[model samples]
Structures are given as C-alpha cells and as structure tokens.
Target: MIKEAIYHRPKDNFAYAYDKETLHIRLRSKKGDLTKVSLIYGDPYEWNDEGWKNSKKTMTLEGTDELFDIWFVEVKPKYKRMRYGFEIKSNENFLIYGEDGFIEKDPKNAHFYFCFPFLNENDVFNAPAWVKDTIWYQIFPERFANGNPLLNPKNTIPWGSTEPQFDTFFGGDLEGIINNIGHLTELGVNGIYLTPIFKAKSNHKYDTIDYMEIDPQFGDKKTFKKLIEVCHENNIRVMLDAVFNHSGFYFEPFQHVLEYQEKSKYRDWFHLRDIKVKALPEANYDTFAFTHLMPKLNTENEELKKYLLEVGKYWVEEFDIDGWRLDVANEVDHQFWRDFRKTVKSVKPDAYILGEVWHDSMPWLQGDQFDAVMNYPFTQAVVEYIAKDEINSEVFKHKLIKLLSNYPKNVNEYNFNLLGSHDTPRILTLCQDNKDKLKLLFLLQFSFIGSPCIYYGDEIGLTGEGDPSCRKCMVWDKDAQDTDLFTFLKKLIDLRKRYSAFGANGQFEVIESAKETNHIMYSKKTVEEQIIITINNSNSALKVHLPFDISKNESMNLWDNKPQKISEIEIEPLSFSIIKL
Candidate 1:
C-alpha cells in the first residue's frame, strides 16, 4: 500500500452533505495503486455487546485523473451522524486507514475513526430547483433592440449601422425587450440574464452610478416593472446584474471623497493609497483593473454593507425579480455574500444567486454564500477543443473529466455554462465562421451538465471579435440574419425540453470508439430515457461502431425526430447525431 499517496479530508468536497439525508464521502489514492476499497461506517453512538455496531460498504471508483483515483460512496446514517474509516486492499497488501494513521488492522476504538458530527439540513447546499431546468439568454440591454426609438440617447446611432465602440449606444431598453418578449419565447429560452441595468455611465452599465434607479438610457422604473410583468406572464424568469463591487467615478459618495480627500466624511468608503486622489497619470487608489472611473467599494464598511444588503433585498421584494448575477464577485469579502444570500433569500427563498467568478469557486458555494459561479473553465476547454482544435478528443475528455471532478455532483447541475458572452469573442468568430464546427459545439454544450446560456445574437449566427465587437446590435432583419441557424437552434431547444436525459442532473458517460480518433461519443441517461450523442469533428466521413449492442431497442434520431434502425452508424464529416434509445 502507498500510505503517503492516500488522502482524505473531513470537510469540503472530500466529505459533504450531498443533500439533506445523504452524506457523500470521497477518498483519493495514488493512481493504479489500489484495486479494491471499502468504507466501514456506522453511527458513532451505537454500541453492541462486542463493541461498536457498524456496517461495511464497498466504495465505487468514481473517476481517475492523471495522478489519482477518486473513490466515492453515499451513506445515510440512521441517527443522522457517522464515524467512518477506509479499508484499502491492493494486490499484495491490505491496510486500514483512520483519522490518526494507517494500521495493519481495524482500530479497536470507534472514536478514532473520521467523524461527521451531525447531518445538519441547513448546511446542505440548496439552490433554486428551477435554475437547472432553465436555458438562459444573456442580453446586453443597449444592443438587444431599439423598440422605443424616441428614448434613444443623444449619442445613439442607427442600429447595427456601425461597429460598436466603448462609448456608443444604440438605444436598447426595457420597452424594446417588452416588445420583443415574443422573440425570446419563440427561441425557447426560459431565463433572461440582463447585464447591469441600474443607473450607470456606460452602455454596458457595469460601472454603477446608482443602485436604486434604472438607467435612463434603458428606461424608467415603471418601464422595467412592466418588462418584468410581461416576462413572468410569458413564464420567463428575469435576473438582473448587481454591480456591488464598485461604484462609478461620478457616484455621490465617491465624488465627495475625491473633493475633500483626507477631510472627507466618506474617506473610508474606498481604499486610498494617498490622501490626494489623482486620476490624470494614474489612480492613487484601488479601482477595477486600474480604471479610475470604476472605484472599488469598501465592502467591509458596516454602513456600506447594510446599504448593499438592502439593495439585494429590494429588487427581489419590490419587482419580484428571480435572481441577481453579481459582478466582480471574487474581489468582494466573503462575509458580505453570506449576508447577501440571507437577505435576498429571506424575501424570495428560491431566488438564485450566481456569482461572476471565473476560476475555482469552491470557497463561495458552501450553502452560506452564492448558489453557483460562471463555469469559465468549462467554456475554455470547449473553445479550445471545438474552435481552436488545440486538443484532440482524448485530451479534451481528460480535461473535462478532471474539471467535473473538482466540485460536488449537485453543484455541477446548477453551474452557469456559457459559450460566449459580453467578455469573449462571439462563437461564430471563434470557430472562424465554420457552421459545421459551430453546430458541433452547440451539440456538446446542450448535452453537457449544467444550465446553458445563449449570448444575445449567437443563435442568429452573428460573428464578431472580442470586447466591443462581441457586443453587437441584435440582428432583427430577416434577410440579414442566419435564419437556418436560428431554426436549428430552436429545434434543438425544443428537443432539449422534451428529453429528460437532456436536462441537468442526468448521468453522463463518455464512450470510446475503436474506429477513429476524431470521433467522440457520450450519453446522458435518466430513469425514463437514455440519449447517445456521437460527433465527427473531422472533415472526412467515418463509420462509428458501437461499443455495445443497440439493435434490440427502438432508436430515434433526436436532430430531425426521425427513427433509425441500426447496429453500427455512419457519421458525416463535421457533424453530430443524437440518438434516443
């Protein structure tokens, strides 16, 4: 046995309450070191005539990465408490592992085993159930439409007339969205994640001037209220962006601090390196990415925290908004988010709290903070494999499997998955306008775990580079838009809704093919149905042999809703097929 290679922690992802009644435990051992492992667990308080009453359960090998094999098991202690230890067996050695150290035999004392004191229901991570079922549509308010042209800003230009810049506006507003709710409904999206709409200086609205009022460029308070009403009536949930991380340069308190310097009453509201605030050559205080216009807020300030907490509670309580997508969430203090969750969930218990965290987010997802973070790691891997072709099928699978193993299974279900957003290049441009590659990427995204999102113009095949280019006006003209791509997306969305296996929480399996390296096969299965999706990213047609027999079961093609009788299948070049069994 490789005693030093074995590792187990009593908290976090290693051992966590998967739900209210089930405790999930994970053990890591050196890859290829152990063939069989078993978990011996029982209520710590249970005592029998011999010693402590216990039960032994075999742990299944959940997954293996480059260096470790992860073993997992879910147990429900009768008394809602447990003391567990591992019994690891290799080809030539058998050893018992406990909290203290490895021993040749099982410990005589139960108290020495790893312990889960109690299964507290409140500690189990709980997100809004509706979130995982949602297909999110992200909209940049200024670029989506120009329904009420009269409300256009003074600098507003003709819609889609020019390539967008940092300061230009095309007058997309709440009224425009209200007029276009039918478009969203037809697209089959159930959730709308609008970029920051609170009063702000720029078109994107990430730099907030005021949190209580809607941006005049977007619309007034009453207009937004009507937009929410129409969205709910159409069964679409609305989530607004919260920019609590920083305030704009002209924000009241921030402006006051700039004028008075050391003597300002609100001096402590921001992190100032010097008493004199300067923005000409460089900023002397902390700001968002050194842009002096966006002054970072002191979230630790008690007064500021209370005010922001009210901001969180107000939107949900007043407008009945479904959730808040926090901006620059990682830079803020953890305690603020914990209180933010409490305040918002108090009024709307099922309200979703999604953070804009681009990296490892295990710290904020422990039930006390945000429900989920943006899954950028997933986005990076997909973009590299599908668009750049930087990694082959085998490498892609390994990277994806390793990423999925980082979090608990339940958290994976609610992760906010996206292909391209306001921050990245459009999907079409990323794939160099190859429609076949784009289709393959979409098939992979919709069939993968986590809630998926469509950036505003992506479904219509809009192509652009990064930053301002990615934030283009929505193409409403039928002749100019890619109608065929739009129709394909709608059909795929409909099928996703119809198939239980296509939804979040379905079991995922990667199937390896003996015939080709450019081919990839995966299946999503539920108790009611199973779906097998096969893809050919190469440019040549290939014959894909099934690893198992499927001739006995009735099979249908999910793309065209056509039935197919088969033993093995032929896949066209640069395309994918979804088979429902």
Candidate 2:
C-alpha cells in the first residue's frame, strides 16, 4: 500500500473539469521517490491553513520515476477551482516545495508554463474583430535618414564603420520616425511597423538586451512618446517587434540566469544542462543550440512564464502601442503564446497579436495564439508568379487563389501583405525594374487582398537585392527617382484607399492570363464595385477572347480614366490592367 506524502494545495489552478475530467498534474521530487503521486485541493477557508491535512479524497494514481506526468482526480463541483500540486513518497524520490511550503519552481526540471482549459462546447473565442485593409510601411532607422544630425550615432563603433552590415547603426531615432509620419501619410500608409527599436547590442536590434526601454541608440522614452504622439495624430498605428524568444548574451535577464544557473532566482528563466556547479559556467554560456550570441529563453519554466507575461503586459499597458509582432513565434512553445495572448489581451482588449511564421499559420489561427502571421509564403508566391521569369501567370494565379481560400476569413483581411521589406530585395530589383511587370505586381499587391505593405523606398523606386543591399537609406531627392514609377505607385495607393472592396469582403474570380504560359486572369467584385485584372504572357501583344461565358464588365477605364473600349480588348505585350466594371 502507498501512503500519501506531505503536500500543499494551489489556488484557482484547476483549468478544467467535465463529466469526468482527467487531470495531468506535473511535479518534481525533493526527497525520495520510487512510485506513486496524489493531488490535494479545496477551500482553504473550509480546510483553513490546515487544508492539506483534510484535503478532499480523489482517486490516487500510481507512477514510477521522480516526476508525475499524469495524476487523475475528480472535481464534483463545476466552477469550483482550488489550489493543487503534488507529493511523492517511495524509497527514492524528491518533493519540490516553495518557501511557503507549497509548490516551489525547480530550475533543474522543465515545467509547462502556458495553461488553458480543455475545449468544451461553449464558445471559446478571445480576440476581437480588427479593422481590415491596413496599409503598413517598414522603416529601417539608420538607413531611413538623419532628420536630426545631433542625434546621429554615426561616429559610434557600429554606425561609424565604413562596412555596411548589422554592426553599422545609422542615427535614426523616434524623432526621425515622428518627423516622417506626414511623409508616410502622404504615401497613404495607415500603420507603421518599426524594426527592433528596443535597447540591444546590435544595430539591427533583433537580439534584445532590454524590453522595458527604447534603445538609447534610437532615442529615449520621451522620444518614443513623441513618436507615438505624432503617429496617432496622423491616424497611423504602430506595432513593435517583440523579440522575446531570445536575447543578446549581455541581456540582464540572461546575465542573472548565468550568475546562478539552476540556483539563481532568475534561473528558471533559462536552460542549463549538465553543469559543474551552481555558479556561471566557466566557459561562455550555451546559445539556444549554438547560435552563439542569442540566448534562448526557457518559456517552459512556470516562474519564467509569469515573468514574461508581466513583461509583455508592461509594454501594452504602459506604452499604448497597438500590438506586437512576435518574432520567431513558431520556435517558442505554443503554450507560451496561449498564455501570453491571454495576459496581453487582458491588459488591452483590442491588442493585436501577429506571429512571425514564414509558412502557413493555420495552426496558430485555430482560435488561440495569434491574430495573423507576417505573410511570408504569400509574399514569395506573389513575387515568384509576377516577378520571376520562371513562374508563369497560370501557376501564380492558382497559388494566389488557393492561399486566399485557405486562411480564415478575417485572418486574410488582417494578413500583413509586404512586398519589398528589410529582409529581401527591393521589389524594384525583384521585378528587374521592368515597368510593365512592376505595375502588374503593384496592382495585384494593392488590390488582391489583405493589409498592403510598402518598403520605405519601394514607392520611390529604390533598387537593391538582399541584406546590406536591401537596407540602403531612403532617398528624399525628388529629382533622383524613376519619375514614372513613383507616379504609378502613388496612383495605385490612392486607388487602394478609395475602394471598400480592398477590406477583403469583395467577391473574387479567376480570369485567363499568362506570363510564361497562356490563359490566366484574376479579378475581384463587390456590390459597390468590380475590378478586372489581366496579364499578357507573350513578348508580343495578344488578343484573348473572353472565356466561353466571360465578358468585359466595365463601362469605363478605372485606373487611367482612359476612354474608348470595345468588347474584345487587345492586351499589350506583358501588359496588365485594372478595369472598373
């Protein structure tokens, strides 16, 4: 017969109970253990400080090993939650407890931090409906400009270097961003997603060293306040890039973990495998797995989960930022996100959560984690079909149509549609600066669906490919750009804001058009308006008869206000159109 060992109860910790809910309680041993674990919980007022002594009797399950992965118990009263942990007793096992003699966290053993109730038939929706058709612009600080010469970090080690790389920091700050809101407004962008601006060791600032403060390299808190002030004034919302998955080696959170490893108060915030002692490792500490400088956060630790939730809440509540673009969201534990979402939203009801997922985000959108992802797959698909010589119009149309069909209705509306961004080549280079091709990509980009995004200089025709090249500073000189291209982008953006259909509630259809192949057309329609798009594939002008039943629906030219239309329209070689029907 197994006897129950000494234990403590948790408060409001039970996440679920049903006709017969099964509890999977996790625990660690501080003393002896060979087998068996039991759960105890109820009203502390009924059982008082003497609660554990008379804790309710539930079915006690048996198990070996020092930890309990599953221990089933019964809850007779629905909606009645109580505190609970576990106790273990055997020839060899340990029982971990808190200073209050309840359940203390053990840095040596991993624990699940994010928690949720089991799915029930009841409505489980958490997030709110957000405004669709948002227009976003990405700004790379140093590369963006020097609105203020005095605030420039240009002479600093990283910024002063002649070599243009991650180490180089240009002197862009909140002031620069605030100074540019009107510029963005004129460009017709509604939201601004700034790259990492938090205190960090790198100019790129992806590896955050501080979560609480704006990086001094960028500006101070007052500057950030001013940026927020100005952006909101112009009706442009801001989304901060939250890179909590990892931190720079010098990050204070990591430093605390290093100082005490498995023993530090902050030890539960990180992972430490086989260690020589409780102090910092003599050799440099481990990276997430050898990434070297970026230390992976251990979100699985319960103590750490509570800590991160607080950090995430602080930003939303304190700064009034619109939302967070969670970096590397896929690599982090899913539970961390579920809990993180719950906590952040609790502080701010309309807080938007966007995950950094390069692929399809169907999993995250299943009524839990994020509102949407960065839309990388869609960006690649759109770029390949329209810009690359290899992907034909037919193939591109199919991919585009299929992507729209797969995402949730609202998810598609809120998807971040970016073309040229800081990470990839400017769309100008991506399309080889081919005017016709660039126009086609732009038309589809602005009209097809989702929240449209513009790289800082994409509207002005800046050209470069990848990394250091893509990060070139924006050009304000009006005389120095491809004038025709600049005018074309401005025109499309103006049209984009004019159409309610751009919000993604419009009807859609596939017409015949061709790039590498022939016969491909993509179009959208709504009660208020209709848009027809066509791309001619061949090098020479081609006439495509309307498909068996397809006919031109527009009475007048949409984009150019061009007149003279016949039933059968001839498409210029490699040309496209946005005809209003």
Candidate 3:
C-alpha cells in the first residue's frame, strides 16, 4: 500500500484551496532517513469506479534535494478537478522533509485536487489590516525632487548624518512631488506614499520635531494643501508618513522632558521606565525611545492620545490628505492602531492606512486597524527563490501558491507587491544589471497577486544597494539612465491597469509552471483576460515547455516589442516574456 500524505498550511495542519494555482508539497519518507524525493504529476490513476488524468508530463525536483524541507508548486488546471500525487523515492525512502507545519509523507495513490471555483487568479493580498487594496508608490522627498529650496534643510545649524549623510537633506520637498504629477500619472500609479515630510530635525524626518505642522524645509501648510488639491484633481491620492511611533528629542512638547527630566509635566508621553536605556535618556512612562534621539510616544497617556488624535483628524478634515503610513508600526501599541482606525475611518471611510512591518503580520491583518501591510514576504520570497537559488522553481511555486492560500480570502484583493522599495537593494542590482532577469521579476511582481509598486528609481533601472545606495537623486537627465528598463516598466504598469483582471482587485491562478536549471515558465488567468509570463534565469539559451492552454484566443506576445500573433513562442535566454490574449 502507498503511504498517504497530509499537507499543512502555515497556521496548522491544513491546506485550503488546493484548486488554487499554487501549492507547496512535502514528503517525509517512512524510512530511517530520506533527504530528497520526486513529485510526479500527469499520471493516470484508477481505483474502484473513479479515475483522474494529469494534463502534462512530470516536473521533477531539481535544485533543493536536501536543504529545502518544502516543495512549492504553481498549478494551473483546466478545471478545479486536477489529479496529482508524489513519487517519494529518496535513498529508498530513508529521510523525511516537512517544516512550517507541512507534514512529511510517503507517496500514496494519486490524490484528488478539488479546485475552488471562487478562487481568484489575481489576488493582491495585503497582510496588515490597516491598509486597503489601493495602488501605492513609495516616494523619498529629497531625492524625488526639489520643491522649494527655502523649505529645504539648513546645513549651518546642527550635526547630521552619523552614517554618511543619509540623515542629511538634498533639498527635495512637497513642491518637487507636486511638480511631477504628470510623471506619476504616466507611470500608471494611482496613489503616492511619501516619506516623512513633517517638521523634523533630519532629512528623513523619522525624527519628527513637531507632530502637527509641516516642516518649514518641506513647505508650509499652504504648500501641502496645494499639493493635495492638485493630486486629488488628477485622481492621484496622497498618503503621508506618520512617524508617531517615535518623535525627535527636540520636539517642543517632548523637549520639556529632555530639558527638565523627571520634573516635566509632559514626561509621561513616553515609556522610559518600561524599557531600559542609558543614563542620559529619561524614563518614558508615557513614551518609548527606539534610540536616544527618537522617543516613542506613549499611547497609554490620555493627554498624548488627545494631542495625536487631534492632529491626525486635522490632516483629514482640514488638509484632506488621504491617510497615513505608520513607520515601525509593529513596535507601536495595538491600542493606538485601534484608536487610529476608529478616528481616521470616522473622517474618511476609504482612507488608506499602512504599517511598516517586515514579517508575517497575520495578527494585525485581522481587520482592526490597517487596510494592508508592506509585503516584504512577497519580495523576499521571490528574491530568495530566484537570486539565492535557495529553492527550485517548482518548490518556489509551492511557496507562492501557499502565500495566497494561507491568508484570508479577501487579503488576496489588496496586497502591496514590489520588486524594490526605498529601504532595500534595487532589483536591477539584484539581477546584476541584467535586463532580461529584471524584466521577468517585474512582470511577476505586477502580474502575480498584489498592487505592484515600482520603487521610484527601480522602474528606471537605477542600480544601487543598501540604505543610501538605493536612494539616489532622480536623474532629471532621463536619457542618462537605463531606458530599456524604463520602457518595460511603463508598458507592464499599463498592462496591469488596462486589464482589471491583472490589477489588485482581480482573481489569480497560476496556469502552468515548469522549473529547470536555466529557465522557468508560468501563466496566470483572469476572467476578463489571461496572460502567460515566462522568464529565462540562466545565462545560456534554455527551452521550457509552457504548460498552459493557449487555445482560448489568439495569443499575442508582448516581450518582442511589437505584439506577435503566434501558436507558440520561445523566450530568449536571460529574458522575461509576457503573452496576452
């Protein structure tokens, strides 16, 4: 008798929506030790009166035979009833492999995959509850552009940039962002998420000096109002960064504590006594300081709550900004988010809120405070899958499939996907300045399951790394950078926008997937349209068997510049290809 296998999703001992396009399969052999195994599909099975068939040949586990304890699979079936199973024969079934709740097993007779019809093929799931399924583009104020130099930081006053002037200002402001509204619209981004523009001692403004006012260096109340008016006029929404998690030590209200120590009446706005710091910093019964200069606000303080809430309300009612993106939100009290959601939603029901958390934020996504979370999991998953060669294509596809299934059904509707962002290394660099690989990742990010965002410079193929390396001043000299990357991003962004089926609000299903040494192939379908995305990750020319049904319509290839109507097409080595029908 073939041994049976039990699949587990991340939360516990269960995997749902097997019909969804992706899945992670694992095998723990019944023997003493088996580090590896093979998963075979398309084999026919019959028992009693029932039988099933696989559409294609088997995809073998290639790269990660030992280290990876999980098998990621991307499934694109004709209907929900796809029959599949594994052939777990490693070291005569010696070792077993299953982690993160996935059960190890010996292959049983082929199992039936009861596909869920309601499952969407394009799910842009946002993990954090505070955010909505809206489009978002992260902008760095100084490097984005120069609005009014007078509003820019003054160099004469104080010491800055402990780590290579990253903390210093290069003069970009609100006017700079407002100046380029047309640029944003052309790029197809509907919402703009700006880094801190509030009154702060540093350029990054993570150390905010005043919670209520705009930085004199970032323009005044009127400049912001004008920018908001213009953005809304163009149907471009604005989401400001609220650094409430921490404030600059120099803030006037907080200054009382810094100057007067325990005697200050405003001292209770921090959590000093709660967390131990060195001698110079005061005890933050009311607030918490992440570092000496940045003091964390004590949401427990009623007085502090009133002040922050009032300021939060003022921006929505008076200035009419869309919402806030809380920085380092994980460390902030959950009660604060609870109050924030109540207060902010009272002002603007559809107002979008986001949190800057970097891990599995399931606790926060339960619909209390945030509408969405910054999806680092998607970014890191794809990156590590491809770049690190940590997981094989089939295994990677399994991870991809489980990501959508493991979360709430609606979360698939609003995930914020990105190839690169302000804080991480650029995608172009990760691809080693290779345009083909970058193009493939770009298509996957946009087409997969999220409202994909092109980090300001990433679309233009700006190659940089680390904190300040990725954050370079936008080259006004458009001709000075990588134009091929720019054009591809533009077209890809438009493709997602034109087809609702491809955007954040649509359904997603991985159609066909194959992972080999040098190449990979996967296709996704939406109700209104279907697209086949392919990538050749190797340096040498590689051929991959596309396991998708191209018979629905005349498939058109967009990767070759002009759309080519063809029965079949091959993706060039080191290139990414997309087909829309």
What is the lDDT of every predicted structure here?
Answer: 0.87, 0.64, 0.63
Identify the runs in model 1 with alpha carbons over 4 angstroms from their true place: 513-516
Deviation of model 3 at 194, angstroms: 0.4
List residue ranges in candidate 2 displaced over 4 A: 1-130, 154-163, 260-262, 276-290, 514-519, 546-554, 563-565
- Considering lDDT, which of the candidate structures 2 and 3 is the better prediction for this target? 2
Task: Give the higher-TM-score candidate: 1 or 3.
Answer: 1
Top candidate (TM-score): 1
Tens digits of per-residue lDDT, candidate 3, 312-342, equal 7889889888878888889878888889887
Each prediction's RMSD to truth: 1.7, 16.5, 8.7
Q: Please write out the lDDT profile of model 2 over residues 1-581, one tens digit for every residue.
A: 12243332221112332223333233333223335555444332233342232243433432122222223355442333334444444555444333235333322221212122333432233344443657778887767766666766645532323436656666766776777677788777778888888888777787788777788777788778788778888888888888768777778866776666666676556655555223233334445446657867788988767877887898778778888888888889899998988898889878878888888777787556887788887888777876886676666665665565445344566677777777788887988887677777777777766777788888778888788878876776778757687678778777766766644555556766554345356666778876666667557776665433324343555666875255466778777655666
TM-score of each: 0.97, 0.73, 0.74
Residues 98-190 of candidate 1 have per-residue lDDT tens digits of 898788877656887899999999999899999988999999999998888888889889999999998988899988899999888999999
List runs of model 3 lying over 4 Å from the truth: 1-135, 156-164, 274-290, 387-391, 511-515, 548-552, 559-567
lDDT of prediction 2: 0.64
- Candidate 1 C-alpha error for residue 207, in Å: 1.0
Question: What is the lDDT, from 0 to 100, of the residue 368 in candidate 2?
Answer: 69
